[model samples]
Target: MYGWADSTAIEVLCHTEQCVVCGDLADGFHYGVRSCRGCNAFFRRAVTFGMQFSCRRGGRCPVDKNARCACRACRLAKCFAVGMDKKAVQPKREGTNGNGIQSQDNSFDQNDSELENRRTSPYFDSVQLTSPESTYSINHSIYAQLTDYTPLRSPSPPPECPFLLRLCYEFSEVKRRRKCMLCKSLEEILTEDCSIRDPATAEDFTVVFQTQMILMFEWVEKLPEFKMIHDPLDKTKLLRAFALRYMLLDNVYHTYELGYNDRLVFVNNNYIIPGQPSSNFNSCEVVNEMEICALMFGAPMQTLVSELVSIIHGRNITIGEIMTVRRLMLWNPGSIGLSSNAQAIASQASNNAMKELQQYLEQEGIEQSEQRLEFLLLYIPALTKHTKTMYEIVRLIPSFGKMSEWNSFMDDVLRGV
Candidate 1:
């Protein structure tokens, strides 16, 4: 429903002198794809300004060198469609050259330098949407005033940052809407009031896994930070890390919340029982748990569900904190295997999210805020221990045996993570 009929297709590189996003003059590679300075500037300004453009003519605008300005939304969409990475558009540095890149890849060097000088100065962390008829300029005093913090905060804190507020809500909504995704399915009647008495069937696990994976992508793609990561491999790697943690954390928390003992609940309300034979966890057929997991563990894999649920239930974790953990787990900029641009963008995004969490806590005036922060952030690594076990179990599933053989979007995710 957007600009070109095939919005997801990555346009092939045309002649060296042609731009991939629009058939304009080429200006080398920008964000891993070849493009022109004109398109580069437009993309940069759009991202840097956080511009949200809409297509009035149903979004199927023709964006070419001759009419790049015809539809801002389509042009921007085409940029991403042709691989113009938003992560490549670095955060607007208050002062030039303060931002750091985590990876040694120099592909970002030129773009970073150029973007540094062109970005809006962070006169104040908050930006206002001015009337389209008027111009907005940086107010140095506002920046100084905003930074002047005291040990004591105002009795009434300001409004929650819009992005953070929206993020918190979106995270919360996922839990509520996860059910009914596949309306009228066999597991549709499963609910919180009951425990999954039988071991989960192979097909039960696969259907839930597929649904989770789909939801994961949906959630990840909406993130502004993840949007910036233009490299497909880097995106996959970051998602891979988030996926295991997401699957494990989301289910464990849901299980604990519903007071379900030692049984993990799926998004669609199907629950996986504890102490089932590993053979019962099959993805190859509708059979109950496959034996491949047992061969790896040399045991029933009882610890998988029981131990996971224990961590959440014992802690009495809250949904607010789980929401934070979900976003924070996207990518650790320091994690190995990320490209330079990906690492830099991830670092900024994760750091911003961390800061936003603190701000949110303070704004809400939550009790023992510092401790609340510590418990969840630290729990990230502790929760990671189960991922190794998870990867071992899921990777052994016959359907997932060869990643390249699968046609689903999860192919890259399963391999990269």
Candidate 2:
């Protein structure tokens, strides 16, 4: 266990470094590293265990200002203050390609270097991408812009950090012009196509998807499982968009699509802020809306949504979902009841659950919708949880094989099931 340095009255002042939390440069050691320790721990817990933190009161865990200690998520974010690389903590495989992630070696360094060179170029310098006169704010403006250009495919890992260039903060003295141009142009071109047709439903979907993505991204960043997955530098925008789309599709198939349009209208009517355009929506905000609905219905509805989709659509529905289905689908009968660790227990549980599902299908002749929905509701949570966990493991050490990693983590709990 890591020791907490809160009460030590110890302020170790250091040169400003990049803050892991907001990706801002800090002038002092506010957290564990050059950043604020609060963000460090928040990053650790959030990234390490994939903890879902809720503000006991509600909404926006304040960072760097008020409510600093209130939210676990925010506090850990403070740790990233000085600088906490979730990727740093992730286990490394021997002799991996660029970006230190396990994936097709596509020369991420070359791409990133080229981008960096362009940013430092004299031509781009003359144009001035990040000056006060420039109209774009990389973080706020560019990120919002790219949402319109959500990727349709899972892009291979790129050599550079996608999020870094994809969304940058408004800095007083902007240095890189080429990078700015690329970022701005990419956002402009990509986002041109990403408009929400039905503002209400689309907004809701956007919110839920954002929350999950943040959770997954931050979680994967620190965990060893991140290393096992593709490079974070890949076409991150595209992958993230795909992830978001999958969640939306799952939502539609599970319940949102099943319900009447009136319910959607009512939900959106009550949920959305009156003035804000539905197109300029935030994922967290939408998640809040969906969460409210979940509370109103008193149902663990998210799980059901994924499960229903997975059952109906046989193959792994989303990249995230695929991770889960693959884990569950790979269980061999011979591996059951053979051990007593957490892995064994989980495997056994999955094996048993699958067996029960098979049995349920065989024994109870229920309507397809009812049966599928019921199974989906139960299975989605399990699958998602496992998928999230597996991703965590992979992020830590990309070398971990599918079954080998699963078996090791769960121990024997899943053994001999």
Candidate 3:
């Protein structure tokens, strides 16, 4: 009887120590509340940014770890009601630009020196491509030049077959030349001084994911094919669907590079091992919101990525391979509400690219070249599965969902779903 009573007391003590906001194990007192880092960060950002939120459910929404993300308004309200001090939040430090004046803008600028450094770096020029067949060389060059050619502002009619092929080629080149971070080898990434560790808090994840999404939008805008989609609605829908799949593919590629056979991969090459506390929680016995989210979503995703890695294991995926797959993904024919003409154009482009890719692989003497071609085709379904999971997770987060209202690109993507 005494043993039972002691156990009950311990259980209550543990429960009391849990974060009041998300019910995750608390990481000690933060901003005057016993909360996990995710909640603590969330509250801090809400206060610091003067972020406004509206509840989809009229403010009565449950604010547990599982449902806390459902309503930002309620979540923030609960934070205040639970004694999280708004005044405890500190101002973000201002960063200086090249001239050393404090810059007010916190948003990442493409023209920043960091990006310029990468563009001029000798490492980017080190990748040596063997001279392709004359046909491939001519097509590749044409596509590469398309980055400099601006699309017509007026909505033009669908391009001709030859033009479609050129557009596909151009897309492949643009993606290749952009030096996608995902395309970098694990060794290269690890050696680079800019590698950011995995985000520990919900706010950090939100910022990193949102930044990646923005970069993806910029990448899409550079595609001649995307600009050809005249209808604003169609463009939005296509971009949204494409963005989701793009993010998934990027993550899968990164996971492959890292050789994370069974671990969960996040943006910026950070990963989480299964059944273990993530790097952020090493100091406390607490389980963070991200760790919980990963556990719930990571297993199936890891399995899917592992299967993909196994298929292409030991072989270095070439620039042509990556380009062809990217081109095929961009022109998704099955996206909801895609027009027949667009579908036809996309299908033709993908088929043409596939033929070109097959020829290149065969010329390179890859064993089972035909099988390797088919493997690229297999990425579509796997990417779709991962994208759907991500979309569901994003929808649950009110802040991300709210993005649709403020960000046109995000709106198009979310609304297209």
Candidate 4:
């Protein structure tokens, strides 16, 4: 009897395949399962709309061609049982027929002559918006494609002496002017009388920077490469290098988010306007010190801030791009004192993050992705330049160094010891 049943199954397989759910003659495979056109369309619609169905009787209704329409809930359950894969379903293509009704093409054509052409075309891939999982799969595929491009290597060491000095000097001058402008704008804030003698207190700047550092630390913890670094010391070192730039970048983002006009940056509800006298010191002493600091280091910091804010606002940088840039900054392979092995790991991680970012940009349908990538690369140098300037300023200011000692993380960042 088993042999007879096997023979009957073979015979049935030899004939035109029937829909596993509806028992109607199958029209090839739809979403990885053989089903008739009607069933295929119904399944597509159900999945697309996230349609739920109720079976009148415990969902045991027999689903066949004639009775399939009687209980959609049972039919859908049977579709899944028969190995219908919703992930395999291609996104619906919209087109208009002569009648002007919007028609959806749900077919997944594996053997189309245009497949290779489409794959090679420089166009963004269409993603399924109906499901998060499907969107992720599509994004993963896009990232895989981006990974096919050359991997990024560690950047070359900085040029020695005069060249580096010249670059830093030019950058410094630009930064100085921008900082002066920022400070002058905030001078008005100081002119207004508050209860406190210091309009822009050191306590306020410290509070803001420290609070931002906490947020930055949390952000760094989320990156894959940072998490992979098992050594606490290494993590601390990386975080130390990352924190300042992260704070500056985040400030740029915040400045833009608050509207371009609202340039006053408040940290922990404390505003740190350049040139504002601190309540902790005599008015003359605070003014002279702030002026000296602003004249020396303010421009470079302000220049970096202005450039970053302008770029982000002008280009409408997405959160995804910002996240990717953060990863790049955090995993900086060129950071001084990293071992060869650490550099190698960082290079690979940075490349992977870049590829992911490329996919994100493509999905956003942003034009000139290649150009955008190059622009992002430029930010690395800007970050390095600004960081060097910040280091110099911190070294010069004994009080800032003392304040940094209050927070262990900030202390580690300041001393680098």
Error of 4 at 192 (Å): 25
Kindly indicate the candidate among 1 and 3 with the higher TM-score: 1
- RMSD to the hidden true structure, all candidates: 17.0, 21.9, 21.6, 24.3
Better of 3 and 4 by lDDT: 3
lDDT of 2 by residue, 194-269 (tens): 2223544332332333233322333233323223334222212213223423333333333332332222122112
Best model number under lDDT: 1
Query: What overall lDDT goes with each candidate model?
Result: 0.55, 0.31, 0.51, 0.51
Q: Name model 4 segments beyond 4 Å from true.
A: 1-200, 261-282, 286-288, 291-298, 333-335, 392-405
Supply the global lDDT for candidate 4.
0.51
Kindly report which residue stretches of model 2 are placed more than 4 angstroms away from their true locations once superposed.
1-37, 40-207, 214-242, 253-356, 360-417
Of 1 and 2, the candidate ranking higher by lDDT:
1
lDDT of 1: 0.55
- On residues 1-417, what C-alpha lDDT tens digit does candidate 4 reach at each position? 121222222122223345555656665657755567777776666566555554445434556665666655555555654446776755567898799998765343333323222322212222233442333222222223222321112223356522222222333222222221122121221122222122444444454454455345434544556666664445555665776777656655556555552233442223334343245444434544564356332565456545555556667666656666777887883546675666776888888878877776776698899988888889767766766665554444445433533433355465652
Regions of candidate 3 where Cα sits further than 4 Å from its true position? 1-196, 199-205, 277-298, 308-311, 333-335, 399-412
Residue 281 displacement (Å), model 4: 8.8
Per-residue C-alpha lDDT of model 3 across residues 1-417, encoded as one tens digit per residue:
121222322232233345656566565667755676667766755565556554443334566665555555555555654446666876665788999988865433223324323423232112223322212111122212222231212133355534333444554333232222222221221233434355333333343454455446545655565666565545545655677677666655655555555654665555545444455444533334454456433575456546554455556766567656666777773746767666666667677777877777676677788777777788677767666666655554444322322233343345555
TM-score per prediction, in order, is 0.53, 0.23, 0.48, 0.46
Q: Give the TM-score of candidate 1.
A: 0.53
